[model samples]
Target: MRPARQTALEKVLPQIAIESPEAALDFPFTPEKVWLEIGFGNGDALAHWHHEFPNTGFIGCEPFINGVSNFCKLVANDDLKNIRIWNDIAQPLMAALPDASIDRVYLLNSDPWPKKRHHRRRVIQQESLDTLWRIMKPGALLILTTDHQSLAEWMLEQTLRHSKFEWTAKCKADWQTPPEGWLTTRYEGKGAVAGRSQVYLTFRKVDCE
Candidate 1:
């Protein structure tokens, strides 16, 4: 256990070392709402959003040890208090979090796992979507960006099929650029440098009966 993080995040987790998402909400909070960013590589965008929205708490989930360490490092270096982490599979983490607890989410250029057979390994599957829906508050934004066209289409199709989520793009520009102050992540900045077009998709969760 990372002693520095134990009090607020311990065994609320399963044996898998999850940071009990439920306990996260109950932690001494100063942020007005919680935002979750899945697969936050190196925490660049996480840090950006933390500074940009000082009143919003963030929980970044990344199973990769390296990424989690990098995120922790950035959190310390930047002296950010509005961030916490689940350095494990988001599935169990989401399982512990209260329903409708989250206000916003970001899935940025996630790993494609490009092989057709490896599609199941992708994070944005139906089960994940359903779980995300369960955790997000109604009308909260889910931001997804991808540089791969096929994957982007796949994401769009899945969210479009989901009854509780509404795609909110009005024009090309909505998908062309991210909102101002959006920090360039390691993956996105590289893609832009390589001249790949990026698509930004935003969805809002609808209230359920």
Candidate 2:
């Protein structure tokens, strides 16, 4: 969020243009899956997901330097090699991704951007959804997690209306439960300590019938 940090990212980050998350990965044969975590604050869930799914290549974007440093410490401690970083707005990065390329997408506990006027900044908007769908392979997952009920409902409704995405909740438990190996992030823990509820949403990309 600092001006200096923004300048640093612009200077050091590589511009690997892939056109889709699926295309961002380098492995072959297994159709190497690419999963993205936008605004990975403190990077706990991203780190855990890396260990759990070793074959999956991950791209994590966060504009916050402090959070990036916290994530770097964990990456160093864990000796992880499957993750890459982009310290800027994820939309431009998404633009570089290949169409129908990403296997799964994660947007967990993003800043609510609360005020009605500032809601435009929320990533769950139509433009964001279009960009998200453009990169995801058919049947690929788009996972959203939030403790903010209003935002959660809004995202659910908006994403559900997208012809390319299909929400996968068959029962209440699916909405209430967290995904596998979903380690608590700093925000998630704070919410829990505050007695707030968390919701997990899964949407599959649908294409070509």
The prediction achieving the highest TM-score against the true structure is 1
Q: What number of clashing residue pairs does each candidate have, in the order they appear?
A: 0, 7
| Candidate 1 wrong stretches, greater than 4 Å | 1-21, 77-80
Candidate 2 wrong stretches, greater than 4 Å: 1-31, 77-80
Model 2 lDDT on a 0 to 1 scale: 0.77
Alpha carbon lDDT at 40, candidate 2: 92
| lDDT of candidates 1 onward, in order | 0.77, 0.77
CA error at residue 209 for candidate 2, angstroms: 8.4
* lDDT per residue (tens digit) for residues 51-119 in model 2: 888877788888777777666655554534567777667888888787877888999998887788888
What TM-score would every model get versus the actual structure? 0.85, 0.84
Tens-digit per-residue lDDT, 1-209, candidate 1? 35543432333223223346566654345678989888887778987788788788888888776666555555554544566777766777787788898999899998887788988888788888898899999899999999998789888888888777888889989888787667778899899899998889999998875
